[model samples]
Target: MTGTIENMIVKLTGWLSRHSIDVLRVSLGLVFVAFGTLKYFPGVSPAEALSVATLEKLSLGTVSGYAAQFVIASMEVFIGLTLVTGKLLKTGLVVMTGAMAGFFAPYVLFFTDLFPGAPTLEAQYIFKDIVLAAAAMVIGARALGARLIPAYERQAPVHEIRERVAA
Candidate 1:
């Protein structure tokens, strides 16, 4: 029984080892970039989607809304591109994770309570943010070298196999 469990565990580890973080990076990157684009540009579609009158009455439609959207967009794009490229992968992940956390605060506090039908909306957003942040943490670990092995790795061989020269 113990042997069987050991074998199973080994198989599981092997399977996990075979997989790379690249897939996760791609997925997360695409999501961030696309969402950022929508938030940033917001153009006609978003304007239509929003409660224009309510937004206008709140003074959110004029300046703050557009400015906030741009900031959100810029961050998203930066994070997404960095994630995809694995550029300063660890550092970027940490920074982006922080930004995402900041972005999550308002939804959890102000917006969540405003919804009559779903007073828990902000909580849900916070939960999702937590999950995303966890993912980012995982990605960041690889960059910081605390993890046993980095995800989505393209590692060099352990030793140089020099060819023997004939006399």
Candidate 2:
């Protein structure tokens, strides 16, 4: 019984470890494609107003309205296609990182409105960019054959964790 359980656990971990990156990539791709498609139909996307407002504020009101939304939608679609197809993945991650940065920038610019006691609707919508950015980082690192964990964390030994736990 013990051996069977151990084998099953090991297989599960192996399967998950192997497929985790693909799962992240595909899910992110799906989200981007769905949201981007929604932007094409006016009044379909909940973020339309927030997007326009953020761009307007970012560009001092010069870059707002339908044009900005169209550009963002195009970008998202391109990123999604590239990600889903696993073609030009690095490029996709780069574009995704940039877009996420822009999406979240207004949070900082309008800190009081966004981060008071509770986040407003727009703030709540854009806050998910943090997770998207982190996911992009993970995918980017995998694309570049690099470690997702920082060098400091990588350098720490298993013994250190055991010692800390013992303490």
Q: Please tell me which predicted candidate would have the highest TM-score against the true structure.
A: 2
TM-score of model 2 vs. true structure = 0.79
Report every candidate's CA lDDT.
0.57, 0.77
lDDT of 1 by residue, 25-66 (tens): 767777677766776555632422232233333445463556
In model 1, the Cα lDDT at residue 61 comes to: 49
Error of 1 at 143 (Å): 1.2
- Taking all chains together, the TM-score of candidate 1 against the true structure is 0.60
Candidate 1 lDDT at 41 equals 55
Query: Which pairs clash in model 1?
Result: 21-152
Task: Count the clashes in each prediction.
Answer: 1, 0
